[model samples]
Target: MLPTKMTEALNNQFNNELQAAHAYKAMATYFSDKGYQGFANFYLVQSKEEDFHAMKFYHFLVTMGEKPVIQGLLEPKSVFENALDVVKQSLEQEKEVTRDIYSLVTLAEELKEHSTKAFLDWFIKEQIEEEDAFRTIIVKLSGIQEGGEYFLKMDEDFSQRTME
Candidate 1:
C-alpha cells in the first residue's frame, strides 16, 4: 500500500503536470498572438505532452492502489517581454519541476519504498531531458537575432516539433 504522504505527493505532482499543460496552452496563445506560428505549434505540442505526463501519473496512482485527486488550475502567465523572455521563464519552470522530482526521489529513498523509487527513476531521467530541452532553447533564443532571418529559420525549425 502507498503511504499517505507519498500518495499526497504523487497527487500534487499530477496536478502540477495538469497545471503545466494549462500554462503551455497559454504560452501557445501568446505565441500565436505574436504571429509566431511555429513557436505556437511548439507550445501546443508541449501542452499535449504535459497532459500525457499527467495521465501517466494518474494511471500510475491507480496501479498503486491510490485514488488520484484532481485539482483546479490557476491562470497561466500570458504576457511576456519578448520571445526570448518566454523561453527564459520556461527554463526556470523546468528547473522547478526538476527540483520537485528530486525531492520526490529523496522522499522515496528515505521511506525505503523501493517500488516508488523505481517508478520515480523514470521521472528523474525524464526531468533531465525536459530541463535540457528548455536550456537548449534558451541558448538558441539568447544567441539569435530577434526579428531577423535566423529568427524566422529557427521558428520554421520549431514548427516541425512533435510530441515524443
Candidate 2:
C-alpha cells in the first residue's frame, strides 16, 4: 500500500506526464503547421512517450492498491520564435520532470518505502536520458541555422527516432 502523501505525489506526477504529452502534441502541431515534417515526427514521438510514462504511473498506482486520479492540464505554449526556442522550452520541461521524479524518490526515501524507491530508480535514469536528449538538441540547434544543410540533416536524423 502506498502512503497517503506518496499516493498524492504519484498521482500528480501522472498528471504531469499527461500534461507533458499535451505540450508535446502542441509542439508537434506547431512544427507541422510550418511544414517541418521531421520535427513534427519527433514531437509526435515524444507525445506518445509521455503517454507511456503516464500509464506507468497509473499501473503502479493500481498495483499498489490505490486508485489513480486524473487531473486537468494547463494549456501548452503554441508560439515559438524558432527551433532553438522550442528546444530550449523542451529542455526546461525535461528538467521539470527530472525535479518531479527526484521529489518522488525523496518522498519514498523518507517513508522508507524501498519498493517504491526501487521502482522510481527507473524514472531517475529516464530523466537523465530525457534531459541529455534535449540538451543535445539544444546544442545542435545552437550550432546550425534553420533551413540550412546542417539543420535539414539534423531534422532527418530526428525523423528516424523511434520509441523503444
Candidate 3:
C-alpha cells in the first residue's frame, strides 16, 4: 500500500503529465498552422509520449492500490513568435518538469519510500533526456534564421522522426 503523502504526490504527477500532453498538442497545432508539417509531426508525437507517461503514472498508482485522481488541465499557449520561440518554451517546460520530478524524489527519500524512489529514478533519467532533446532542437533552430533553406532542411529532418 502507498503512504498517503506519496500517493497524493503521485496523483499530482499524473495530472501534470496529462497537462504536459495537452500543452504539446497545442504546440503541434501551432506548428501545423504555421505550415511546418515536420515540426507539427514532432510535437504530435511528443504529445502522444506525454500521454503515455501520464498513463504510466496512473497505472503505477493503481498497482500500488491507490486511486488515481485526474484534475483539469490549463489551456496551453497557442501563440509563438517563431519556431525557436516554441522550442524555447518547450525547453522551459521540460526544466519545470524535471524540478517537479526531483521534488518527488526528495519527498520519497525523506519518507523512506524506497519503491517510489526507484520508480521515480526512471523519470529522473527521462527528464534529462527530455531537456537534452529540446536543448539540441533549440541549438539547431538558433543557428538558422526562421524561413530559409537550412530551416526547411531542419524541418525535413524533424519530419522523419518516428515513435519507437
Candidates' TM-scores?
Answer: 0.96, 0.97, 0.98
lDDT of 2 by residue, 1-164 (tens): 88999999999999999999999999998888988889999999999999999999999999999999999889999899988999899999999899999999999999998888998999999999999988988888898899899989887888997888
Off by over 4 Å in 2: none
Query: How does model 2 score by TM-score?
Result: 0.97
Mind giving the per-residue lDDT tens digits that candidate 3 earns over 26-91? Answer: 999998998999999999889988899999899999888999997989989999999999999999
Query: Each candidate's lDDT (Cα)?
Result: 0.89, 0.92, 0.92
Cα lDDT of candidate 2 equals: 0.92
Q: Rank the candidates by TM-score, best first.
A: 3, 2, 1
Model 1 regions more than 4 Å off:
none
What are the RMSD figures for all models against the true structure? 0.9, 0.8, 0.8
Candidate 3 residue pairs in clash (backbone atoms < 3 Å): none
Query: In candidate 3, residue 25 scores what lDDT?
Result: 94
Distance from true location, Cα of 16 in model 3, Å: 0.5
lDDT of 2 at 124: 92
The stretch of ten residues in a row with the least summed lDDT in candidate 1 is 138-147
